[model samples]
Target: MEPQLSHHVEGAVATVVIRHPAKRNAMTAAMWRALPPLLEGFARDPGVRALVLTGEGGTFCAGADISTLQGSPAQAQTLAMAAEEALAAFPKPTLAAVRGHCVGGGAQLAAACDLRLAEEGALFGVTPARLGIVYPASSTRRLVSLVGPATAKYLLFTAELIDAARALGTGLVDEVLPEGELDKRVAELTRVLVSRSQLTQAAAKEFTDGRTDRDAHWAERADGNPDTVEGVAAFLERRQPRFTWSVAAPGSPSSSGSPSSSGSPSSSGSTSG
Candidate 1:
């Protein structure tokens, strides 16, 4: 059969599969070209609330399918960049269900997701430097913004293998599970996410997207909000930070006692910036 992107829906969650198992699920230029419209369809369809990205066989993604670029490097590069851009702009909350060998462009794919639920055996790296290619500026910035300068440089400079533990320590993967139970874990996460309100998810995503710049907006929210106050108060009280990041109308706080919840601070790096 001709290679194609596969998607199946179960309730409010949609699973998008990279179906070319013969290549260990390495992404093709065409597949990358198709993601934006696919994601846009999901975003506009009210029936879908969450999406999970994964591979069909035992692997996640190996990187770009170099074989596909034999005749068109320029086209391949353009397609890859647009894919990453679309993924970054995907409005709904996205999760990456990472399995074996999430390396190179695969790592970029996972990094594009809002959260990563990685299998224990999966590996991650940004391998453009090893291939004499420049990683996209936006992708590089996204990586740097997620793991900070030191860790991002360490990956890009070395192009070395990183395991689940290292990924967790460096804030790469959100959850890691044994190979046997990875699917179940992803399913559980999808179930929970499907129950959340779209407005809340979009707001949280927007607020996070705004933090990419070294600007005054991020500063004000992180430094001077009631959420920050309450979070700190809760921390001091030996209680959980009751993060109230809901989609209340502007100036109409969710609760009278808690004025506003500031955006999350610098340390908790999500998959996005």
Candidate 2:
């Protein structure tokens, strides 16, 4: 099949598959451009409560197809950065389910997610150094935030692949599952994410990303919200809380009692060369 980003929603979760198996699912320029708009659509869809990013078959992404870097490298970099930012800014929970190799731009995409689940033998690296390319400042900062300055420097300087165990020890991934267990673990976590409150999740995402101006906005959202009430009532009754509050679409009034549409934030025709 031609390289593309394909997605399907199942019971409040959207799973996006990166298909470029011949290249270990490397993202091409077209694939990078395709991601932002695809994520925006999911963000606006009220039915989507969480998203899982995974590669088709055994491998995750190997990175951007470096052969495409020959001409107009600036434009290609711009597209990749845009895609990464879109994923990072997505209000709902997002997770990367990784297997095989996840290096370079692949690592950037995985780091952009709120959580990452990797298979035991998966290998990860940040490879701009190998190509004499300077990584973007934002990407570097994000990397440093995830795995710390020392480990980030080690990866960036050496361009060496780290095993999943080391990646986990250094905080590069949230979970490292046994072979054949990645999908099951990802499903379990995503279901838990779907059952939670979007109000809390959205606010926490912004705060964690270093946005300090939204405290009042979130305060208003929490005041008299049905989610808070239901949570309390459910706890008292010894039952699971049914959180109904969804993010409101941009410029739409946020309602406290029911699920509402959310404000926003792919596909390739297929890279790692």
Candidate 3:
């Protein structure tokens, strides 16, 4: 069966499931190509505030489907690049709810998300070395950005499968949960992410995504806006802030943000600034 990305919306959260469990949710070439559009759909959907990425059947992911590659190094690498581009460009807060065996390309997918939550016994590794493959530059840079060059080099060069605890320590996984508690923890985290002001989150993400690395004006362009002022007011008043998302809105005569009606913090993928 073909791999698919399924979405379910709950309040302000958009849960995206990687429903390719037969391959342990391993990414197929087609699945890699499908991510951007799915994410784009979520990016523009107002009902979605934050996105949760998880695999079906408790297994997070086993990376790319080697069988699909037919032992073609070039083909496998291409597939990885396709997946990398889409995840990296997703304009929202993305969380990876990971479970058993998040290794190889799966590890890279988790690394691409804004944050990651892993099951206690989940394993992580960059197995390119094991297969005599050269990792893509974007993935390599992202890994280094997360855990630093030394740690990135160690993981990539050794291809050792490390425990979830070590993955957390190395800045790979943000939080670790026991097998059964993963859902509860993710739910709580998702709630927190959705409740925050999207304005701040989006701008923060823009800069965080390294988009601001070469743009001196990015910070200035994103730090504050009308919605941010409203967020502050809402905080002081202890009321829900009415976020305006259109350029043609009552107070937002020139606004433009994803999720059209009003953007939740998730839409900012804030790394865009």
- Give lDDT tens digits, candidate 2, residues 38-68: 7876776778899999999988999998778
Clashing pairs in 2: 26-271, 34-266, 40-265
Model 3 RMSD in angstroms: 5.9
lDDT for each residue of candidate 3 in 15-90, tens digit (9 for 90 to 100) = 7766676788887777777665566666666566678888877788888888767767697678678666667666
Of candidate 3, the 10-residue stretch with the lowest lDDT total is 264-273
For candidate 1, what is the TM-score?
A: 0.76
Clashing pairs in 1: 227-260, 227-261
Whole-model alpha-carbon lDDT for candidate 2: 0.86
Per-residue lDDT of 133-251 in model 1, one digit per residue for the tens? Answer: 88788889889877888999999999998998789888888888987888898888887776554444655676686634434443544565555677679879997554443323354
lDDT, candidate 3, equals 0.74
TM-score for each of the candidates? 0.76, 0.92, 0.83
Ranking the candidates on TM-score from highest down gives: 2, 3, 1
Lowest-scoring 10 consecutive residues by lDDT in candidate 1? 264-273
Badly placed stretches (over 4 Å) of model 1 are 211-273
Model 2 misplaced stretches (Cα beyond 4 Å): 248-273
Better of 2 and 3 by TM-score: 2
lDDT (0 to 1) per candidate: 0.72, 0.86, 0.74
Q: How well does candidate 1 score on lDDT at residue 216?
A: 47
The ten-residue window of minimal lDDT in model 2 covers: 264-273
